[model samples]
Target: MARNNWIAVASAQHARRGCAIPERGYMQVCHGKRAPLQRVAPGDRVAYYAPTVTMGGKDTLQKFVSIGLVKEGSPYPFDMGGGFVPFRRDVAYVPAQETPIAPLLDMFDFVEDRSRWGYKFRLGLFKVSDADMRRIAQAMQVDLALLQFESLLF
Candidate 1:
């Protein structure tokens, strides 16, 4: 199957936490819902967009915080203690800057309505066009060639 590009919405703090996890592995989406993670496969590209500094917070910080390729494996439950377990998928995150989305708002075809571009982000996780993905990678200062090469190995 052809690889797909996905955009996941999360808070900047959570997105950064996902990237900082040991081995640069694992991402949980849609509040750790397994259904969303199940749609992703090994080699697929994943980028995280944060609209706030903290979950449910008013502090705005719209940015593309993390970009990486999904690693081999199905989603597995992770014990966060407090009886809260969330499903997570392994990912090989790459180096990238936290890029703002304001400038790129007009560049994304997926954002149909620039004024209400955030509608899709409400879905938590969704697929994006390859063109949009490339544009995001560029905005985030991510090396697409490296991501492609890494994807091929999976």
Candidate 2:
């Protein structure tokens, strides 16, 4: 499968919880919509961005926090059994880390104005260019060799 790049924005609390769930190995987005989730595919690289300074009681400097490879499958809705069904895909995440977005603002095309970096991530789930994805992965200290290998699989 040709690898694509995706960005998922979540609050600090949600991001921490999602990353910690082994069975729920994916990031959930657009709680009330399916269009965004439908775009993600197996083998795609995913970057989880959290806007809060503190996550899971630790200081994060408000950055992109997790990087992973989306596992094979379409979006599936997990019933939390209390009318709390969340649509998600499976992701094999790497070790969690944080990279402040401030330094990387100028590198992203979506952030036309550095002073307005936060606006670009408002959509929660969106596609990112391969170049941007690589930059983010590098910033997050992910192993590029491993990331490339993961991107090659079907």
Using lDDT, give the best candidate's number. 1
RMSD of each: 3.4, 4.3
Best TM-score goes to which candidate?
1
lDDT of 1 by residue, 1-154 (tens): 6999999999999888999964856799888899999999999999999999999999999999999999999999999999889999999999898899999999897989888999999999999988888889888888778578334321
lDDT of each: 0.89, 0.77
Per-prediction TM-score, please? 0.93, 0.83
Q: Itemize residue pairs with steric clashes in candidate 2.
A: none
